[model samples]
Target: MLAVALRHLLLLCLCVPATPPLLAESAAPPAEPLSERQRDQIDAAASYALATTLFASSDLPAALHAFERAWRWDPGEDQLLDRIVPLAVSLGRADEAIRYALIRAGDGSVSPEMLRRLALFASESEQWDEAKRLYELWLQSTPESSNAFERAMVRIELGRLYRRQGNAAEASACLAKIQKKLLAAPNSKASRQIITGLGGSLSQVYEMFGKCHLEAGELHLAAEAFSQARDELETDAAANYWLALLELERSQPLDAYAHLQQYFAAPGDPLGAAPYELLRKVLVKINDREHWPAELSRLREQHPDSLYGLQAEAETLAAAGKADDAAPLLRRLIDDALSEAAPIDEDSFAACGVWLLRHYAATGEANRVIPLVSQLGKVHPSLDPYANVIKAAISDNAFAAQVNARLRLVADQPQTNPAELLPAAYLALTAGEIDLATSIAERSLADDKNVEGDDLLSFAVGLLLADQGEAGAGLIRRALEQGAVDEESPAAWYYLSAGLRGVDDTEAVNAARRAAELAPASPEFAANVARVLQAAGQTQAAADEFAAVLRRFESDPDPSTRATLRETRLSYSYLLLQDDRVDDAVEQLQQVLDEFPSDPGASNDLSYLWSDRGLHLQRALRLAETAVAAEPDNPAYLDSRGWGLFKLGRFDEARDNLAAAVNATDEADPEILNHLAYSHLALGDRGAALRDWRRALSLIDDAQQGLLRAEIEQRLQDLARQAGVGEAPEKNPH
Candidate 1:
């Protein structure tokens, strides 16, 4: 009975809470429970409480040990197993966690939260097979709890695993499942957020698909994938812009233009003027067919100061044949652009000048060219050559003369550009100073030692020498030997071949033939070769070549080339007149005058032909007067007028104009001297005529020496017979 009482005391000691101990050491030992069931219950309760504390502090190793001991004492404590499974997962023991989770999940004892945690942990550890299996178990055991968000997240994780493994098709299938679920429950905020988070991963999958297709050269499929991604994205300006660029790369300008317009209109896009400028070019191409006036007008109104808008307006007006209207707008744009103090690109400046030149030339508004020239002169000094040429076209003689004088000053300076000197030389030649022109041309060519192949400067000098009837053959040979004359160099070959023909070189004639063969499509080259062949006595070949040139280039030849061709035909007519083919020459001159009614040279030449042939002197005088008024300061036109007046018996007017032409410059022009002599002779001033004629003969070069000598001899004989003086011997022109 005492033993039984002690056992009961032990049972109480184990079951009840412990009492507070005294401070002194020496205390009696307390009895414990003797029943196994009570011992197990006490141990289980203590272990569970400690495990809870350990689990709360995230001490998974200790928590697992305590939980295992709890489970061992109370094997039916399935809740302890549930706690231990999650702790195992928290400790990165996913395999152990999943094993226990599956067993409890199968027994209908595991909570859905615990199963879900186990599956996510397995997925995080890249145990995709285990993660997938556990997720399936959870779904099967708790199908009612399998909502859209849970199912979508599980599929998204599987998709990511497949994507990592490079199984894009399988990955895409998984991602599609998430998309389908989200779409089906579009109003669910939780599902939408889940899908949105997964959107990035899905986008990457689409990008991978697009890139693979692109690498395989399947552009259409690649474009389709890119389109899918673009549609899925909420805010991706770069992606949209890249799609437009891809369209552009495929030469789908219309599609590209549409996409780019949309991109530019989108909010918060950072692509700047690049897209707008490209769109302008595309619009210009489409504008050829589409009447986009309102669209262009809107762009101008909304973005009045945008460079692209200005360019579009300028192009539209120019295309519509409203150059007069376009000129002011272009000027305003230039001013506005300059006022912005933005750094001017070279292209912008060049575009401004090019637009103005096109408009002014097209409308025949030569006066409008002056302001552009002046503006270009002030802003871009490197463009002085083009500016001076435009300035010289001004109707105001004083303004034109001022421009020529300024260019002369620039050309005379020691540090002046050698490239600019050639034009200045031509200006001097036109001003009737052959000696100064020759000097300038020679000096310019000498200074330009480093001139590149086929440049304008080298070609200009070669043409200048040839036009002057000087030793240009050597320059032509030098240019060709330097490889400056090739298929790409039409202008170079044209000028060099013309120069060689001037010197009667057989080698040059063959080289000219080669140039024609190289660029048969070049009208200027063909025309130049024809002129040379005619000069070299190959009339039939020259005629055939000219016919071919006219046939090919009649539609859209360069204006300058057209002018040169007209002048060449006029020259050929003059040659025919010299050959005593008077009717044919007259017909040719008539055709030229009919074709180019505004050509001053053709008018002057035709009038001179009429005067020389003694046909309709009054008409010749009228045409020559008109020519002189058109080009008031031109010495050639002035000479033509003076000759025409002399032919019409207006000797006094002729004398006055001829004297003005003679004193226009220091170096005498042979043609001007001849005109003055003829005027003096017609006015019964034989002595003055002889003096002028002798002066004219002295001014001519060796090429014209024979003609001058014959004229002088005839005049001398006529004077001797008229004045009762002995016949004077022939005097050498040299």
Candidate 2:
């Protein structure tokens, strides 16, 4: 059996192409001549053989573990995903499946089914934007011969998403397309069956239309459509659920109660106990506490085994500050799921573990928390971060020591998996073992062939934020070097450029320029090149690059691309303003307004610029008003409007707006405070003006706010000289 196993492992190793050694054998020390790549190949082959044997033996969990180990050792082997993705899906490890599927997507090998599943998972997780993107991508890849029902369902979902995003016109257009597709089908028995499955009935369509309006806040229209839908599909219970929601929104609790009753009486609510929570609300509104207990009982009976019941009970206990009462129930739910020989949902299952960990930690049960972390980590590798976090909280010194010991062991090994080291490195960083974490991270980067550049860059940024500048810059250089060889994509170079910022000016600009050269059609990449050039103080070249990208996207119709163009224009205008080109800045702002007429940022910025120059005071005030009306609570908008009002000699109104702006924000913005100070000075409150100016001056830094600081200081001096009282500040010490 051992010989046979060795033969299988040898065959697997032979089948896989040999990855290039991390270091050439000639360059390696005589004592340790085996390169990291050769060690990884051995590890991957052994793990793969073990995985295959376990899979044949029907030990799926062990098989999955072995497969993951193999893949971690051999990330460049794309074929390993063939087994990994399906196994993860079958094991109900949605996150794992999605992660590998995304890798396959990058390699352009993702299946339509995988894409659809990922989209649904995102939607269920309430990551609406990601869900919309995935759904759109899946639809684009789907063929015409795809199932009619599934296609219609996706269209309905798209319409629902559009409405939820407040794009009513797009939602309406989506519904029209769905209707048209059904109507366009051939008139035959098979066609009719397809249409019926596609939800072709007007009533069903109207119900979806009502949902769209509901999400888009067209409540009255939603009610009308729901009413029509309810009449046509009187027995369909779903219409009743929607009608109940509409009635609740309209504040007709009695009607809502009736509809909810019909909805509850129906066989099953696809929404689960979501409506029961609403019913509970309606009962409270109607002051009918008598039915509360019975309703709770009905819900408990509906979802037996204390599934929803235990969750609600735990929540109520926690809310009431009964931590002791909630603990057992939480433990029961967590233990039951863990002990059961059934497939588990990774996210939901791990969420319970995290909650229990939190509870245990809060109660000071480090013992309980440690064991639970061990249990949960076995079930989901993603829980490692959370487990390490909990362990650190329990004893940072002990955890750091544990990580250091593990690091030493890993270092002693001939080859170390970067994946295994990353979590420990992050935990060490979190535990304030900066040197140890940096060492681990450096070791991870040593084998650059398998290094994920994004992960390396992320760790580098983390180190930079943690005040390890030199070390961070070194890792960033390593990531850039790896990305240069492996990814060689515009986005990769652009991100690497961003990573190099504040570290190496020349390299950052070169990387950004390389990205632009690689993808001249990408406005974002080109804009990034321009921005980096501006940062490098090559103003003329920056302006030229900006102009090139703008001209390239001049007639582009993509909304996202147009938004990017608007942002690039704004950035270009800022660059022009910094160079004191007032007319050029105005032209850029005017172009922005022409393209995005109601854009509040452009309006506010333009108004501020015009007010600052004392040019077109009336138009600036109107523009400021427009911006304020759009984002009434925005401090910057209020500051612009107040400054415009101050320029117009409206001291009372200006002071009010300025004060409101000051009071609304947690931070005392120097510019806003300066405007408020001027308003106080105009109102003949020199003492108040002096105080505000001092506060503003204190907040202003000498770096970028030098001019503003000087102006405020001069104003203070003038006011003090006029009053002939206390002396003003002489100058900024720094």
Best by TM-score: 2
lDDT of 1 by residue, 660-731 (tens): 877776888877887787777776777888898888777888575677667766776777786785544322
What TM-score goes with each of the models? Answer: 0.35, 0.52
Q: Per-residue alpha-carbon lDDT of model 2 for 182-298, expressed as tens digits? A: 445546554466447656775776788888776656677678668777876778688888888888888898899999888766664455445766777788889985676577677
Clashes of each: 2, 0
Pairs clashing within candidate 1: 10-32, 10-33
Q: Pick the candidate with the highest lDDT.
A: 2
lDDT of 2 at 225: 69
Give the lDDT of residue 264 in candidate 2.
66
Q: What is the lDDT of residue 537 in candidate 1?
A: 78
